[model samples]
Target chain A: MHKIWAVVRREFVERVRTKWFWVSAILGPVLFAGIIVFQIVQSMGGAVRNVAVVDSTTDKLGPKVIEALDASGSFRATLAAAGPGVIDSLSNLVESKQLNGFLIITDDLVQTGRAEYQASNLGMQTIESLQRTLGKLVVKARLEQRGVNPGVVDWAQIRIALDQKKISHGKAVSDSATQSFFMAYFMAILLFMAILLYGVNVMSSVLEEKTTRIIEVLVSSIRPFQLMLGKILGAGSVSFFQFVIWGVSARVLLSLRGPIARALGADPASVQTMVLPHIPAATLAVFIAFFLGGFLLYSAMFAAVGAMSSNEQEARQAQQPVTYLLMVSYLSILGLTNDPSSTFARTLSLVPFTTPIATPVRWTAGSMPTWELAASLVILAIGIVAVTWVYRVGILMTGKRPTVKELVRWVRTA
Target chain B: MPEPVVVDRVTKRFSGHTAVENGAGKTTTLRMIMDIYEPDAGSIRLFDQVGGGRIHSARIGYLPEERGLYPRMRVLDVLVFLAEAKGVSRRAARVKALEWLERLGLADWRLRKVSDLSKGMQQKVQFISTILHDPDLVILDEPFSGLDPVNSQVLRDTVVDYRHRGKTVLFSTHIMEHAEKLCDRLCIIARGKKLIDGTLAEVKHTHGGKHVIVEFDGTQGNARQIFADRQLVAKLQDFGQQAELELATGADAQEILKALVNSGARLARFELASPSLHKIFVDLVGPEAATAAASGARGANGGANA
Candidate 1:
């Protein structure tokens, strides 16, 4: 045991000291959150734009329509001139950059309800401006056609409140409707990114050592399973520690969450109201089990690949086939999270390799049955032992590359 | 104490090739110490008390011809690991490692990566690692392959120290000089067969004959005619006017001198030097096997990555 620990501690220290690890183990989450916020900002910021419109229709939109559309104060719509670069041709205005964009109400507009939608991804702002402006014209036309004054329609829409009862069991109160979906998605994504980050971390760490020939010395002292276990736990602990800081940081920085999120380029609104309500303690217990079992079970196999490869580069190559399998699990879980009872997701959840990632996802989605989850965990336990035995024995075989037939024979004899 | 190693007829074979084929053609086999190849047809006892491989391998250190050290591992770390594995306390391992590094004049390089070290330095580090466990017996297969004079001496000194400390060291080297200088006894294997075994002098004694040198005056052509009796003339020299001649075993040197002088050949010089290890190796293992011997065994210049 001391020898095993000596091996483990040495591996732990060696890995933790490396530049690649500190970069990934410490910086990976920061980058992940950064990317998320960046995406949100990019998405929301691109949703609005400025545009101008000119009508060649027989029946033109009223002046009030433009004012009504402009009244929202979301974007600026410049009414264009009637010349060569006029508002009649959207292509010209956009090409000249004189206007951000324009909408042409062609001669058949009122008679035909068809509206074409086009916008450069770089010019996505044009989409919203056209929508808002044209939305006003349609509303105005409908009101006038219904013989209701536009003022009455506008005044009537000024607001009527439907007080929704937040009926929990028996109580009557109101809460936001979209909050549950947002909360579920947040929980699901958190479980996802956490698993992925650590799993790849396991892979990359194995790759680095495999490439460096350090694994050879390491395997001499401890079994490969122990090495893999120690690394998975050690790295997981490091990641877990960081995540704890993130959790505490979230609470301690509650006031600063907004600023931090913005700085990180993530959005607070995305995960807001996204908390699961009253997770059964048992389900959470299973999730923790599945998480550990999954990391160990899969990470051991990863360590095996590391052992088989002569260097880090080859190990990375060997890891891809397994990683792609993990990816399938992740994708299937994504489908499962949508409907946990779906045949595909539930079936994969039982497989030992995919179970680790998929089971927890289904649990979070509240789709896993208690017996099935127990069975998966049991299968995972067996896999851990069996794989550990193989990894431990196989790691020390020098210079001989075992082929599939050879591996099968060895396994049977073993 | 029983002999440190004893091997009674050992043999080893690979798939189709035999590495240490058999005990046949053997020089001298260790009877008391640990024998490396477990006898396929006999037995080996190590340290006088223990028998079998597990006992010997544990007590006896070995440096295989194959490179076995972790390439990227720190030199000190690998040494210390081996030391501790040999049952030394971690502290002792550290202290011993540093002492070895300094004694080997590698003190400044205690922390350098093993792979970064020159091949000679790396070999030295491996040497240090092999002996740090303080095994009573060590079997170094070609220990002095890639080394310059100075580093070779450092290793040579370390081996001497091990001997001074009463450790019995046995190493195989194709460098006859290293064996001549360091070995107390040897079992030279040629074509996977031992050719000779004994103390240097013992074997040289068996190689009887009072050697004679006939440095005839450069003009003394047809020198064989001067000592034309094939029975009296053991060999003739023909080295572009400087030929060496060894008289037949137990032949009188005076007879050759008389013959050459009677032939009116003026002698330039005369002297006798004991047979060198190289000559003995060639004679016993055959001239072909002698040529197979590598010249640079000692990093006499203190190089490790020779």
Candidate 2:
């Protein structure tokens, strides 16, 4: 154990002190800072919509619609006079770039509740707000015509907001699907990138050691299994360090969003919406567990590849299948996020190859069953043990790179 | 004491092909003793610990034929780390490594990256790391293959020092010179089989000493004819002033030397000569096996073996 720890310490310190580690470590936070700065700068450049309203209905809703559109404070609504040529005139204004878009309320709108919106780019947010504003106006005009009690109508119009809360144990916690989605997305990418970077770091280290013949010296004093575990733990710790740094930096930057927004002369209120998602302690534990499991599974295979290979090119060639396996898990994150409890998604979460990223994502989607998580963890543990054993025998191999068949033979015969 | 290492019919075949063909079995055999590979059949005992039993890794120092250290690491750090990994504490490892560095004349280069050092320097550092933990049994595979004469001398002296410290130093080499010079007991292996095993004197004695050398001032061309009556000379090389003669089996070297002196020749020198290790190796293992062993590009023939 002490020897293993020594190996781990050496691997960690030697690699951590490298310029590449520092560069990549600082690079992540810096990139995220740059993104926040970019968002702030974009927000500072305000969005102004110049929309014209064309009313062809006998209800003569153009002026009222103009007032409502202007009241939204996002669009500058102009009343285009009702005429047979109003559509052509408004479209001409849009084509000439004077208007961002034009909204047409036809006589059939009251029955169909359909209105035409044309723009060079009709953003979803803009379209949703436009519909809400026009729908309210049409409803009010119809209500007044039907002689509904004005006071009762005013009371009935009051919108009651539903507060979403998730009950865990005895406490109700605020749960936002949007927040969960964003959180899951962030963590999935974090896990994928971390695994790829550090797992390959282990691979390349093994290959370099093998090529330089340092492994022979190392194995002389420690079992190859100890060496492999120490290295995986060492590199995994570095990845964990990076994860913590990025996580803390993200939290700090998120909390500083208001000041950053103010610095950019943008609205602090808008920036306040960029809150850090609240990850439950249990969920955090699960995330870390799966992260390690996934990392170990791949890193062990990579170490085997490194041991079997004679050089960097050969190691890379041998690593292709495993790399593709990782890529498949990463690419499947999107589909898993959409339907975390779906048969395909749940099944993938059970598979050792995809379980690391997929299981955590399913958890975040609030659909991961406890049994599945436990089963995957067990499967991953067994896989790590098997891979470590196979690669320990592999580290003894020298000279030419072994074929897949040869490696399998080593594993079986050993 | 129990033999430091014993391999009893140990065999390892990788994917149906034996590793012995290219003499790679040297490495494979060492690995089995180190428990890096389990033998397919037979058994290996280290200090009477059978079934590849747990020998403290620190008790054994192995310098594989493919010698190396962490190239990007500082020399001192690499050595200390290796020692520590062998169960030496950090402080003790550091002091010992420094002592070794100084002894190897690499004290000044301790702070330098291994890559910054020359190949020979790196090799010396690697050698230090192997024995820094003061292991009881030191196994070096082809230790002198890549070294220049000076470094090889340095390594040879180190191995002598190890033996003086009462350590069992077992090293594998295809080149007979290193084995002949350094080993008290030697084994010649070919095609994964031990062809010869004995002390240096014993092996030479076994190959016999019926060879005689004579340096004379008189007749040079008639020397072969002088011994022709008894057909005593199996092979003879006349070097003008000096000649060598390998006697036929049962032919007496003393009788031949006396005959040469009585042939009215003023003799300058005459002595029976024992076969060299090169001759013994070629004779015992056969020339083809020696050729294949030397083909690994790590062995030297020392003129005669060539």
Q: Estimate every model's Cα lDDT from 0 to 1.
A: 0.59, 0.77
What is the CAPRI rating of model 1's predicted complex? incorrect
What DockQ does every candidate get? 0.08, 0.51
Instruction: Judge the docking of candidate 2 as incorrect, acceptable, medium or high.
Output: medium
The list of candidate 1 runs beyond 4 A from truth reads: A22-255, A259-320, A334-355, A358-403, A406-414, B2-93, B110-124, B132-139, B192-285, B290-306
Q: Per-residue lDDT tens digits of candidate 1, residues A102-136?
A: 55565444445545533333443455555665665
Relative to the unseen true structure, what is the C-alpha lDDT of residue A180 in candidate 2, on a scale of 0 to 100? Answer: 74
The residue-by-residue lDDT of candidate 2 on B1-306, one tens digit each, is: 467677787778776877643223677877777766677777887766764523567787888877777888999999888888778999999999999899889999988999999988888888888888888777777788889888898888877776666667778777777666766777677766666666777777887557777898666545667756456887665567877677887887777766766666777788778766766667666667765342111111121112
| Model 2 TM-score on a 0 to 1 scale | 0.83
Candidate 1 per-residue lDDT, tens place, B1-306, comes to 356655555554433565444443221122112332234455555555546433444365666554456565677877876565444567888998999899877888888777788877877787787777677766665666666777677778877777766677667667777777876565566766656666666766776355655565665744567556677766554454555556676677777777667666777865564555666566666666775532111111111111
Window of ten residues with lowest summed lDDT in model 2 chain A = A39-48
